[model samples]
Target: MQITKPTFYNEFSCIAGSCPDTCCAGWQIMIDQNSLKKYRHCKGAFRNRLLNDIDWKEHSFRQYQKRCAFLNEDNLCDIYSEAGKDMLCDTCRKYPRHIEEFEGLRELSLSLSCPEAARIFLSHKEKIIFRTVEKETPEETYDDFDYFLFTALMDTRDYLFSVIQDRSVPCALRRRKLLACGHDFQLCLDQNELFQWETIRTRHQNSAFGDSFQKKIFKWKDAEKSSDNLRKSIWKTIIPQMEILRSGWHDYLRDTLTPLYTSCDTEQQYQNVCLEFETFYPDWKIQEEQLLLYWIYTYFCGAIYDEQIFAKVKMAVVCTFMIHELAVGTWLLQQKQFSFPDLVSICYRFSRELEHSDQNLNKLEELLDWEEIFSLGNLLEI
Candidate 1:
């Protein structure tokens, strides 16, 4: 079997008690079967605590006021402190390090929902690189696996990453190019013309496609006017439909974004805020590129499982765009000044709310198809 991970995969270390937000809280932690058996057999001073803390009926750790029962006042795991790391469950052991499995492949990525992972990703100025390693494991097979489609998706994703990382191209142009590539690839997939994907990829990588996409972007920019009401409507309509993981998140969005959107009297003022804020943070574009690449690299390949290629790309685009919008709202809250830390906070929080919930992810994907919410033209307008 082969494993693939980002270059920064090994660089993540949990902040533990020092974490601004603890993953142990505000989320359900499922106990794997192995861990459950081990806990049942555990015989020691900590055994009672383990048995008490877990809700075996649900196969999950019990939460005390939305915080993990094991999490103490210091925001550290009491179970870990008592029984050491060996006693931790699989979910606890492999947090932030997410594993997506294929027939014989394991793709590992650090979940942006973790604040430390978010900081590591946003702090890096260089282009991200992926690494692969082979391991001796028994081969597994799946009846539904599509090797050809998977290969094509990987090649297409690699090309998209290259375009995104190209420093000479503006970030907006790179995004347009990626959307164009996905649009074209989706058309072929819709027609069951998977064999033509290579040709489509090659065409997208060519200079002519980039030039044409740039022209389209220019025309869109000329025609598009930023609207605070449009932004408000988008968030208002979409945010409520998402599965609410933490009530605080819903309240946070309401408290922070609602006022910001309402205060902007004109589209020009909103655009000016975004423009001036970018000036304060000159590397905003690079940060955005990193975010886009991260989302694409982590989730895009999973399209092989469901053949939702375009939806995956749209998810990446919409996610990065929403994060940017949240950053803008945050800047307004901070008196027109934005910080890198604030950007990191927004990315991780957004990921925590959206990425952590499968239901929410599906809802967002559904919303993408709804023309009233996020049309392709609106997504491409950026």
Candidate 2:
């Protein structure tokens, strides 16, 4: 078995009760079979409470207004403190950290859903290093797994990350390179010429990816104009969708976005938005880099097992970009004197809307098949 994780693995400990937002709330905690059986035959005074607390038919613990039933006013879990640490289900025991299994490999990443996890992920000072170690003994295996496809996927992911994390190229250029790489890799996979991956690797490293990208930008009949139009259209669609994620989201959207949302006719709106971001996040470039890094890191590694390469990449990019857009919306609201909770509320809500929805995921996957002229760098452009 091979285990892999980012270097920041040791830096996280659930803030638990003190968390500005509790993981115990706002999401379903699925109970595993073993835990369910134990809960069924429990012999303690808490057994009746357990039976009542769990939605046994649904195989999930009941939530109180989106929070777990066991959560106390102090945000602590009553079950664990009273029963023992091991008494909690798998979902309760391990959270914020998600494990994606691929054949003999386990890739670990912290979910951005947790505010504390988000802060830690976005605050990293160095390029994320993925460290892999083989267990002293081989671990369990799936009934049928494709090791060859997994290796090929791993290679392609490494190539994608190299393009994304390359600092010399402008962010837009890096994104374009990645998109191109994904396209070419898909082609190679279709032809079953995995051995020629070396050629793609070479082309990625010593190519004029940025120069060609800039040409593509200028060669378009009306590039900037089209971009402005796209930006307006995208935000118009996204803002409304974000409203469905949680309560008060519409208020946050209206308070933050409505005023500045139309303040500048397309021409100056971009500049105003840039200035707003600079005013709020200070060194926003570093954070943008972190976002790109995280998206590529999490999804790229997972592609090793699931050959749904394009879906994973598209999901990564869309999720990060949506979060960025939402943050901008929050910033726009804050400039109008909204509170931090307003922004945090918007973030959490937007996450739930996009992250939790099967329909939204399918929509994004479909959109990925469409022609794309804008890249992450273009989004970053002031």
Candidate 3:
């Protein structure tokens, strides 16, 4: 068996009580069977507290006013203090460290939903790198796994990462190229010409393709009115459909973003604010690129399971765009000032709302696919 993770994976440590936001709150903490049984047989003084805190029928910790029952006044876990780290359930033990299982491989990633993990990710100066290690274990197989498709997807993802990290290209152009790569790949897949991915990749690398892409981007910029309207319309329609994980998050979006969308009388004014926000934080582009790369690396390869290759990249693009929009709205709210810490807060908050919920993730993908808002041209326009 093999284990893979980002190079910065080991850098993450739970800040516990110091975390600006507690993971113990605003979400369900499911207790694994082994942990549940341990709780039932617990011989310690904390056993009664455990039995009272957990809802055995649901295999989850009961929340006290949207916080875990075990979460103490200091925002620390009482279970960890009383019973030790070994007592934590699978979810609690492995949080932020997400694992995706393949036939003989496990890919681990730190979920940005954790503020500390988000800090490690967004604050990194260098491009993200993935590392893999092999482990001795039992053999495993998936009856319906498509090894060939998976290989192609991995190769394409590597190519995309290289393109995205090629600092010479403007981040916007990198995004355009990434979307173009997805568009071409999807076309080939639809036509059952998956073998031509190499050709598509080769074409994208050519100087001519870059020139043409730049021209289209300029044209996209020229059609600001229509594009802005489309962008706003898409957000207005989709944001409402998302499964609201925390009512506060829904309110945050409504309170912060609603006015931004409505107040901008023209596309130019909106673009100006985005530009000004970027200028306010000189390294904003780098942060944005890092964010895009993180999402792509984390979720793109999962397309091998569902074969929704384009949708995966589309999700990354749309989510990154949304995060940027949130940042812009936040800047407006903070008297045209933005801080890295606040941006990190927004990123993790967005992740917590969307990434933590499988239902929301699936819904976003479904909405993107059904609406086709992330089509090649549309993505470029945005």
Candidate 4:
């Protein structure tokens, strides 16, 4: 098996008690069956504690005020504090280390939901480089794996990386091309014409209709829409659909967006504040590139199972843009004052809200297909 990860992948180390924003709180921690077995038969001191803490019916830890039952006042895992690291459940032990499994591969990444891991991502300014290391491991087979489509997705992902990492091209163009390619791939899959993938990928790689696509997209973007529309669409549309994990997240969005909604109060004021933000946070482009690549890399190939390739790509595009908009709102809230920690908070908090919940993910992807705001043209305009 081969393990592929970013250069900074191995740099993640949990800050534990030092972390102000602990992952254990605000989300239900599921206890795996294997860990449950261990807990049920546990020895003296910690056994009763585990039994009381574990919600047997739910196979998860009970939460008091949304904080995990095991989370102590210092925001440290009480299980680790008393029972030792080995006693932690699979989820707790591995987080924020996330693993995505394929036939003979395991793609491991540190979740951005952890503020520490978010710092690692935002701090690394260079273009991301993926390094694959071969590791000997047992292989498993799937009942109905779409090997051919998976191969196509793999090859297309490589091409996507090329376009995204090509700093010579503007980030906007990279994003536009990514969504365009995803749409094309999705069409081929829907038509049951997997044979056409090679041709489609090549066409996008060295676009023969470059001039035509530019003209088409340019005209589409020039349609009647303003920055205010983009802001409202991205901000207002997401909140209602999400399973708000924290009340703070609800208040956070309302408070941060007050700039665009109240302080600016006019189209020109909104646009001017946004323009000033570009100058205020010039490295946003770098962060944007990283976030797009992060989402794409993490979830793109997983479409091999469901073959909803376009939805996956749209998700990547939408999420990256959503975070960028949030960054703008946060900056505005601070009266144009932005700092490194602000970026980390925005990235991790968004990850916690969206990525942590399967329901939110499904609702988000479903909306991307039928939502007027997520239409390809609207996304480009945004």
Candidate 5:
């Protein structure tokens, strides 16, 4: 078996009481069957509290006003204090430590929705790197899985990593290259020509291939470079339609977005502000790279399942784009100053609202599929 994770994966440690927000809150904390049995068989005063806390019908913890029943005033888990870590359910124990499983591979990543994890990733100055290791297990068994396509996607993902992490290229051009690659591979995927993925991946990874692909992308994108209707429409029309996990998400968007796109918000004006904002806070290049890497490394390979590879890239692009916009809004709102802490706040809150929810993730994926503005070409309009 093989396991892969980010280099900073070990740096994640839950802040508990000092945490700005509790992971225990805002969503249904589902209990696994094994832990359910543990809770069912426990004895003593804590047992009664467990019985009260556990909603047998839903197999989830009860919540009082959106906060978990076990959450105390100090924002710590009562379950941990009373019964210890062993007594906690799988969801509680493994939280912020998300795993994506395949035939013989386990991809481990710290959920960026957690404040600490977000802070750790963003604070790291160097580029993120994936470390893979082999562990003894059963043979590489994949029943009815397209092992070929999976391997192809691995190559494609490596190609994308090269594109995004090529710091010598301007950040904007690198992002545009991502869209072009997605569109080309998606066309091949549609025509059942994934056999050609090697040629496709190699050309993209080759240094000389960037200029032509970029020229073609420039032809597809609008001439108005400073326009940002894509971000505006997504923020104004799409986001509100998704599941609202936390109470203040809408409010943050309102504060972050409304000011950026007011009644008289012209596209050029909006674009100019964003350009200025990005230019002033040049670190946005790195921050946006980290954010995109977070989404891609986590979801790109999983595309081999349904083969909606474009959708996965689209989701990452849209999410990263909007997060940068949110940062722009945040910068404007904060008298034109944005800091690392502000970024950490935005990253985690956005993840808490979008990444943590199944409904939201599916909804965004579905939207990215059919929405014209989210098209591979249009997304590069930025």
Candidate 6:
């Protein structure tokens, strides 16, 4: 078996009561079967409390206004304090520790969702690196999994990260190349020509198609107001999705953006907004690019097995793009000020809202399939 983690993966330590917001709030905490069983057989006073605290129909801890039942007044987990850390469920114990499992591989990453994890990630001066630990397992079982494709996927992920973290290339170009790679990779997979996949992968990895992609982007960059109508339409479509979040976000979006520029359609005005965004978070573009790369690379190759090519690309693009937009919008709303803590808070909240919710994910996947929306080139105005 092989296990891999990012270099900063081990730097996180949950703040418990000291956090500005607790993870125990703002989401349903689903109890595992084993934890449910353990809680059922308990023979102490706490057992009654546990039984009362859970909503048996949902098999989840009951919440007060979305806050976990186990959450104490001080924002600490009372269950952990009373029953010891060992008694916590798998979900509870493994939070912020995201796992991507494949045949004989378990890739672990510390989710940027945790404030501590975000701190460790953003505080680092160097690029993130993946470290691998490999040892033989006592028994090897067989399945229909493609180990060769998996190996290729891992290599492709590494190469994709290199492109993303390459500061020499502009973020716009990096994104263009990444999306093109996904589009081409899909073609190969669709034709059942797995052997020819390496050739296409190498072309992108070695900048073989990068020059043409760059030319297209440069051409589009000079065009004025060509993307205005597109941006407005997309903004209109996406704003509705934010209804799942706190109310007033729609007004917040318009108030912060519309007055500043009069319209999202104006090219120079949008450029100015981008400039303002850069000023507020100077390295936000690079950070956003890196994050997009991380997510795309991690999920892209595995998506081959499921053959959901466009959905994977859409997931990566939408996540990174929306995150950048929200961060920019939120900072502007706060009078053009933001800090690492605020950025981390936004990252966690966004991911928890989208990635951790099945209803949302399934909806997004369905939306990805619809031809009228979820266009990478259209969304980016490329």
For lDDT, the strongest prediction is 4
- Model 3: per-residue Cα lDDT over 1-382, one tens digit each: 9898989899988888788988888778888999999999999779899888899999999997878999989989888998999999999999989988888889898998999999998998888888888999999989889888888888899898888788886787788777778877878888999889888777777743366768866665434337677777667767788777676777898777865777677778888878888888877788888888888988888887777777888887888888988888888888888898988999999999888778888888888777755556677777
Candidate order (lDDT): 4, 3, 5, 1, 6, 2
lDDT string, candidate 1, 107-129, tens digits: 99999999999999889999999
Q: Write the per-residue lDDT of candidate 5 for residues 94-212, one digit (tens) a residue.
A: 88999988888899998889999888888877988999999999786767888888888888888788778888877788777777788888889899898887787677667433567
Question: In candidate 4, what are the lDDT values of residues 1-382, reduced to their tens digit?
Answer: 9898888998998888778688887788899999999999999898998899889999999999999988888888888879889989999988998888898778888888899999998788888888899998877888888788888988999888888878887788888888888888998988989899898787776762368778767876736777567758776787798898887788888777766577676677866876788788888878888888888899999998877788889888888877877888888777788988999999999999988998998888788877878777777776
lDDT of 4: 0.84
Better of 1 and 3 by lDDT: 3
lDDT (0 to 1) per candidate: 0.82, 0.65, 0.83, 0.84, 0.83, 0.70
Which runs of model 4 end up more than 4 angstroms from their true locations?
A: 208-210, 219-222, 225-227, 263-271
> Deviation in angstroms for 92 in model 6?
0.9
| Per-model TM values vs. the true structure | 0.94, 0.83, 0.94, 0.95, 0.95, 0.88
Give the CA lDDT, 0 to 100, for residue 11 in model 3: 91
Q: Which residue segments of model 2 deviate by more than 4 Å?
A: 190-196, 216-225, 235-245, 250-255, 304-306, 336-352, 356-363, 366-382
Local accuracy of candidate 6 as per-residue lDDT tens digits, 276-361 = 77886777865776578567646666674777765677677767776676677667667778777767777776676666666766
Q: Model 4 shows how many backbone clashes?
A: 0
The alpha-carbon lDDT assigned to residue 93 of candidate 2 equals 83
Model 3 TM-score (2 dp): 0.94
- Quote the positional error of residue 330 for candidate 5 in Å: 1.0
> Each candidate: how many clashes?
0, 1, 0, 0, 0, 0
Q: Listing every candidate in turn, what is its Cα RMSD in Å to the true structure after a full C-alpha superposition?
A: 2.1, 3.9, 2.1, 1.8, 1.9, 3.0
What lDDT, from 0 to 1, does candidate 2 have? 0.65
Alpha-carbon lDDT of model 1: 0.82
Greater lDDT among 1 and 6 belongs to 1
- The 10 consecutive residues of candidate 3 with the worst lDDT sum are 216-225
